[model samples]
Target: MLKLTDKQALEFGIQPVHHQMDNGELRFRLTRDTGSSYILTLSAEQSGWQSSHVHLRKREFYIVEQGWIVLALRQSEQLTFRRLGPNDSFMLPPGLPHNVYLSEGSVLHTVKYGSADADWEAAPELDEKLRHETFDGKTFFTR
Candidate 1:
């Protein structure tokens, strides 16, 4: 994962802060400080996984630009999964506990609507709650 500073993002004409997550995911904030609205881009390498968490009051929209990703979502004591590829999109409403696994060289454009504070609630033990299987280079999860 490539890490960039705010200055680097400006120099690169991205215009927003750029940073790397602890898991090595890269993010470029395209818009910010707009109160409940933000846009960003995220990139990850194969086998990379985003942390499991939920947004209390934010709705998230994702557009896959390259490669693919698998989303694991938990709802009403049930876990489900979805795989999305290039040009595919998904909108996640508030209160959904989820995590994402990125395929090789995946790039995603995302929009957050509803709260600027993130209201992020992390569920670190979520992985233990899933029943999953991997086949044909992809992983699927279910309760």
Candidate 2:
């Protein structure tokens, strides 16, 4: 799991609230004062792949703080797979269908414009292909 150094934590000037998810992942909610929020998440190797979903109105930004992760995004009839590692960042606009596969020791830092629980919508149709497809460690495009 990636963590903030003492110097880094002091620089941020914010306290984080910790939570343990049901999937055994560790999450830290860093800020929630305004309409936006920041979150830090550490994924367990055994956490497996996440289901496909989309946000109807919310937007999200993510940075890979440690280890590796695969983001599978579907746009229209085409699908794109992006393999991300430390320092890699991406943004998801509203109405984009996506899923994530976190590798062992993966850590992600996220910024959200709104509450995920309220805007999240499931996209079960993408699950079958997204979960079973092979990622080649590069950006891949498929129909």
Candidate 3:
């Protein structure tokens, strides 16, 4: 396994992709790809949400680097949500639908494996309520 420090990862550089959300700009930076797995960093310049999505053949995982992310996962017939902060990590098996919302100016590191290209099916309506909420350092609340 290849492990890299934050500085090392930065030195490797990233291909940043930006998306405009209703709330703010969401940036996804792809840093490494190893055919079987990809390493990337994501952040929201202001505040925004990533709609729920599922990858049919890849296991997805992420670690919080700065601020927080509210992660919601759906499996079987249940949906659960967790608020994660720095150093926190979570993973989801293939076929599970999950949503990740980053607090304003927050950062997250992600790893996607078991597939090369991402085949994501979006389910934004799954957590529509969260779309209107905002994170305020310690907690999330409706704005």
Highest TM-score, which number?
Answer: 1
Angstrom error at residue 96, model 1: 0.5
Tell me which residue pairs clash in candidate 1.
none
Cα lDDT tens digits, model 3, 39-73, are 44446466556777888988888888888888777
lDDT-best of 1 and 2: 2
Q: Model 2: which residue pairs collide?
A: none
Residues 1-143 of candidate 2 have per-residue lDDT tens digits of 89877557646655567887776778888654344668888987564566689988878898999987788888895788777899999999989999887776889998878653567789998887776675444554455
What Cα-based lDDT does every candidate model obtain? 0.73, 0.77, 0.68
Q: Which stretches of candidate 1 lie over 4 Å from their true place?
A: 1-15, 37-42, 130-143
Give the candidate number with the greatest lDDT. Answer: 2
lDDT, candidate 1, 1-143, per-residue tens: 99998778657444565788786777876645543434454554535567789999888898889878888888886778888899999999999999877766778887877875748888776766532434234545444
Greater lDDT among 2 and 3 belongs to 2
Point out where model 2 deviates above 4 Å: 1-18, 30-35, 114-117, 134-143
In Å, residue 8's CA in model 3 sits off its true spot by 19
